[model samples]
Target: MIIPEKFNAFRIHQLEDKQIHSGFEQITLDDLTDGEVVIKVAYSDINYKDALAATGKGRILRTFPLVGGIDLSGIVVSSIDGRFKTGDKVLVCGAQLSELYDGGYTEYARVKADSVVPLPKGLSLRDAMALGTAGYTAALAIQRMEDNGQIPERGPILVTGATGGVGSFAINMLSNIGYEVVAFTGKTEQADYLTSLGASKLINRHNIEMGSKPLESMQWGGAIDNLGGETLAWLIRTTSIWGNIASIGLAGGIKFDSTVMPFILRGVSLLGINSVEMPLSVRQQAWKRLATDLKPTKLHFIAPTTITFSELPSAFDAYIDGNVTGRTVVEINENL
Candidate 1:
């Protein structure tokens, strides 16, 4: 648990050209914030937000010349609080780690003590990062659905953007709880992969043809929707009476045309899933569930790869290009 004099971090720099790009840089410990806890970070994962922030594809970062990683898991090297101590295994996700603060793409991370979650008993650091924010959001969605009285007996649930990290976790978690999952993705090549992750049925994103009807055939019992536009609108119209739809992303267009017919007639509910500011107690429960009941059986299939710390900059390109099918963790400080 020796703190390094200088650590290597994937630092994003803003140039005079008003463009931002990330690369490895050597920085001293004083350069990082001395929060309640300092962790010798071991694993970090790339998410769509990270890609957008790194590649200037979207407005992900509120500031520049900062380290960028939204999810990280590792061991605590030192703690100023009695709740945590040196040599403790811990993990963190969301909590604005990357957006407004120096983040996980570093040899070490110093974060607020309250933002860290004790790594669940049955989970490894690698597994924790594998789940990361995506899995957390999926769990949050299901918890919201269950609170709305959703159950396996209701009918099949639909997961849009099924090839991405959140969608993959949603399929696995919903199916693990005995709900039949209908996964929708544009990537037809991932048919076998999605099926292996417990998708009972697969639908091509392009094949979903819908009219402007306020109500379509009652289809889904409940749904975990990552895309927002037409797909969400369709789910609202087609979901069975009393069914819930948890909206998680805006990867598709943000707004959609919808009418009151579905809501007035079907009593459908739209739940917005936000993982960043989730209460700490809720995060603990979600992580515990993920380590037990919600643990994805096919995480090996969902997050099938790992990249070294040096490979992180290039990895963002794959995410930006939408070539990433499953989660990939960045291995940091493994050699240390």
Candidate 2:
């Protein structure tokens, strides 16, 4: 493929032993990695990982002078694969797009043909970006729980980190599907917002005590936990017998000091969820669910405050400070 002469990209360039990413001067398609399809990106969204890349806080960029968004939705401007053609609408997420490859923080992106998913019939490109990686992860978690035999009639389920992107979507999707949802959040101020998202009860994050007890009173029938630390361990110990707990993010920390008594004695299960390496089939199913059963009635309420190309940098900072709520999508290409 002939690389275009000019394109726009948000790039992280090395400067004085540091990396900085923001709106910069025009970049060429020549700067992108080789792929079978070239997309004119319509929308992209900020994730926790995107925040790290924009701020250079983590080693999210495997290479420098890279575009930083991990997810995007767009129209294929050109394609080498017969399965896709020029002008095809599609979306992409969780395929090392930002970390190991040139990504969607640009006006155009060249992506491997197999890594893309066709936009679902009922979903618009803008709505796909609004759901983004967070909503997809939440849907995957819910699917896993159901596949593992979890049912709403068993008991009330718990959602930790309830105000963030994944958590907000999980709460609404679960509750909308007839499950009783108890939401936990550090932000007491967001109680009304969580309630509006269909959370049945709000549990104070501080009140979710993590003590030395190896086990505690049985509580949740199932759980979708985003923060994975002592809180996760506590959730493991307290989940009802034969319940499923899907462990997603690690904003709290990674280490889990847990006991096997919950597994052996209570038959509880801890399912680790990695949205990044999800197989293509599972990814397709998850997004289909997002457009159907797991779709949240109040999805717009969980959007990352929409921003333009120029406002992305500050939005990234707000995400890092934990000040942002739900999903934050960047509108590009005339909001198509």
Q: Best by TM-score, which number?
A: 1
lDDT of 1 by residue, 75-160 (tens): 99999989898889999997887788788999989998989999999999999999999999999999989988998887999999
Clashing pairs in 1: none
lDDT of 1: 0.89
Per-residue lDDT tens digits for candidate 2, residues 1-336, read 234689678877656757564455588877888889899999999998998887877778877777879999999989989989887899999888888888888888999888899999888888898899889989999999999999987789999989888899999999999999999888889988999999889899887566667778888999999989888998988899899999998878999898889999999999989888888999999999888888788877788367887777777777778777778889767756
Total clashes, candidate 2?
A: 3
**Scored by CA lDDT, what does every candidate get?**
0.89, 0.86
Off by over 4 Å in 1: none
TM per candidate: 0.97, 0.96
